[model samples]
Target: MTQPLQIGLVVFPEMTQLDATGPLQVFAGIPFFAPDPGAEVHLLWKDLEPVSTDAIMTITPTKTFAQSPPLDVICVPGGPGVDALLGDSEVIDFVRSQGSGARWVTSVCTGALVLGAAGLLDGYRAATHWAAMGMLDAFGAVPTDERVVIDGNRVTGGGVTAGVDFALTLVAELVDRATAEAIQLRIEYNPAPPFAAGSPATAPAEVVEDYRERTAAYQARRIAAVARAAAARPTP
Candidate 1:
């Protein structure tokens, strides 16, 4: 039997749990995941520390970044913590190293910013939360206005909820279409949001404007953090 594909889901304080957990759950349901052991998922962080999610949830890392197994896939999930992590040299260095070695590198929502900070997004077509799309250019990535964008081995998802779709798509890419479809069916992956405000273009102008305004301060902080990270990196 083929060895299980080792997958790493990176977590940090204040990260959105759904970004990692949703995908992790989907990948765990594949029959081959246990029988043939298609994939084995591990939660990794800078240390084996307990990380909090937006202050509402806490999770413990299964492994430290330095000790994480060589990964077939590495996923980064995002949330408010991204603002702080963007300037963390240890996190950036860990991400840069693992991303370079992994077979596929994936991100959900603002997690793309982490990849950008690690210098992994350069010259790639990537997507992030619509509210943060403009910031992608700052990191030299082409900002794609799509739910999901796959550029070579790097796959990125837009907004928070797009994580499910991203994981389904990744299942097809990494495993097989049959396995992905089965997992989707098992999970009843069809989505129906009660409101149509999920996208900026679909929401009322006032609502969209308000959302952007609310997140403005956070965005400013993230930009400054990314700038500092960029400045501190050794010249290549």
Candidate 2:
């Protein structure tokens, strides 16, 4: 607990914007939490350059791996770019180093795979995007499918949208229930979607099938990347 909680959210090409931004918004607003009234957010990348995301927007890194200060929380977001990240020693090493000292190690969506690749998820029960649930085992993680999953100091959000929930949960843990509720209410973090197509269990079967088909090639590549990363992971 300090005046400014240092939080770093990883950035890379083709990452799901919401995966990082959802948590970023929550962390950025942490000053509103009276109990712990300050939080410094850092967008981390290999360099201080603009990184494109799947949402078509771009995020410029506020800190590079070499320049990043010790973080209280380290979060890696997931997307198509995670495939390359899975095998990226630099990114993996950065995550591993941060996670080793951070109070919280987290991810949303396929970013869990990157954490897994970094040898951080072994024996941990973590959550990720539904499509990547089974991939956790490659990193010795017990696959979970909940909106948010917390195992010790490790916290993971299911998919992109789950990042907000994940961060609020962290707020509650780091600050208090009152601060978290106040922030939630101030942000009007109410969930009332028009359709129930969020999850495969409720989504139209045809829609699920279509999506699976559409992303088959991409998923295959991600799976292969996970395998390679797992193989390269140093045994503990």
Candidate 3:
């Protein structure tokens, strides 16, 4: 790759900022990690406005979809806002258009659903947030249970935090493992959570049940949204 790497990350309302920023942090360190043939990561949206997140803060898009340069990678991040993205043709069309030409198509967490909605993951093994795992089948995707999955040029991360791992893996693909590891070391990407309850399998039964109960309505809405997006997607 003689040219500079151009990576585009999609941002929207109510998205989990970490899903994009986590991987972004890793990708942004490419210059320091391996100075030659540097990278340019663009935060993209339909317009150049500040997008809100699931948290209190908001993120501003660096480029509009129409204004973005050709991207080597197109990555989407996930959160509560993903439900609306399922039914959004503007975002879906943008992904479909850009992904068709990008060297890599990827997502973090439920952002996989957006790629699916764009018909980008058909017949590919992918990963998404645990809660949205079952939705992959609707898009003709094989849902793999892993923190990160790479099937051909399509890379996906399990959830929000997995974005860091996802990008590090992509960096290895773009450059080398040594560079990726150096970036990892630079970031000190160590995981030693205080609790072992991140996943449903490890969480207490009551805690899991309570979460399921709380999210039942949201999941129901998501299912319906997925159905619509799947139906609206063009067949390949």
Candidate 4:
């Protein structure tokens, strides 16, 4: 029997649950991928304690960073915790270390910030929450506005809802297009947003401006976090 693909998902305090759970649900829904009919998905956190999201959702992590199994893929999901994670040496080290062993490294939403902070996004094409894209260039990454962007071994998705598309894309890349299509069909992955405000170009000018204004503080915090992380790194 083929060994199940072991996926490690890193969860942090204040993370957006959908960013992690969306991809997780997609992968876990694939029954034929493993001998036991269930693929292995491990939620790794700094602590094994329950992690809460900004939305007040919480989940228990399966493993701590030190105890995580070897991973075929490492997925980092983003939320307010990304500000904290960007400056966390232990978390960044864990990401950098495990990412080297994994066949693929991916992020959803501002989780790409963590990858950027780890220096993994350097010279790579990446996407993130539109509010956070400007900072990717600070880490030497080329920012794209697409919902999903793949560059070599790195895959990134834009914003919260993009996780599903990112995971489906990854499914096609790792297994086969047939498998991905089957899963998409099973999940009824077709999307039709009720409103056109999903993208900056489609949103009213005032709404787009308001979003940028509201996120200004968070962006400032992220910038400081990234600068601190970059400065603290020992000369390679």
Q: Pick the candidate with the highest TM-score.
A: 3
Superposed Cα deviation of residue 209, candidate 1 (Å): 1.8
Q: Which 10 residues in a row give candidate 2 its minimum summed lDDT? A: 28-37
Per-residue lDDT tens digits for candidate 4, residues 102-137, read: 899999999998887787888899999988888787
TM-score of each: 0.94, 0.97, 0.98, 0.94
- Candidate 2 global TM-score: 0.97
In the order shown, what is each candidate's alpha-carbon RMSD? 1.7, 1.2, 1.0, 1.8
Position 191, candidate 4: lDDT? 94
Residue-by-residue lDDT tens digits, candidate 1, 1-236: 87888889999999988888888888787555445657778899878879999758799999998889888888899998898888788888888888989999889998998888888888899999887788887677899999999999999998888888999899888878878888888889888889998887899999988977997898788778767766654433
Question: Could you tell me which residue pairs clash in candidate 1?
Answer: none
Runs of candidate 4 with Cα error greater than 4 angstroms are 32-38, 233-236
- Please report how far candidate 4 places residue 106 from its true position, in Å: 0.7
Question: Which 10-residue window in model 4 sums to the lowest lDDT?
Answer: 30-39
**Considering only N, C-alpha and C atoms within 3 Å, which residue pairs clash in candidate 2?**
none
Q: Could you tell me how far off, in angstroms, the CA of residue 71 lies in candidate 2 after the best superposition? A: 0.8
**lDDT, candidate 4, residue 176?**
76
What is the C-alpha lDDT profile of model 3 across 60-177, one tens digit per residue?
9999999999899999999999999888888998999999999999999999999999999999999998889999999999999999999999999998899999999999998899
**lDDT (tens digit, per residue) of candidate 2 on 1-79:** 5578888999999999999998888887778666354788899999998999987799999989999999999999999
Report lDDT (Cα) of residue 7, candidate 3: 91
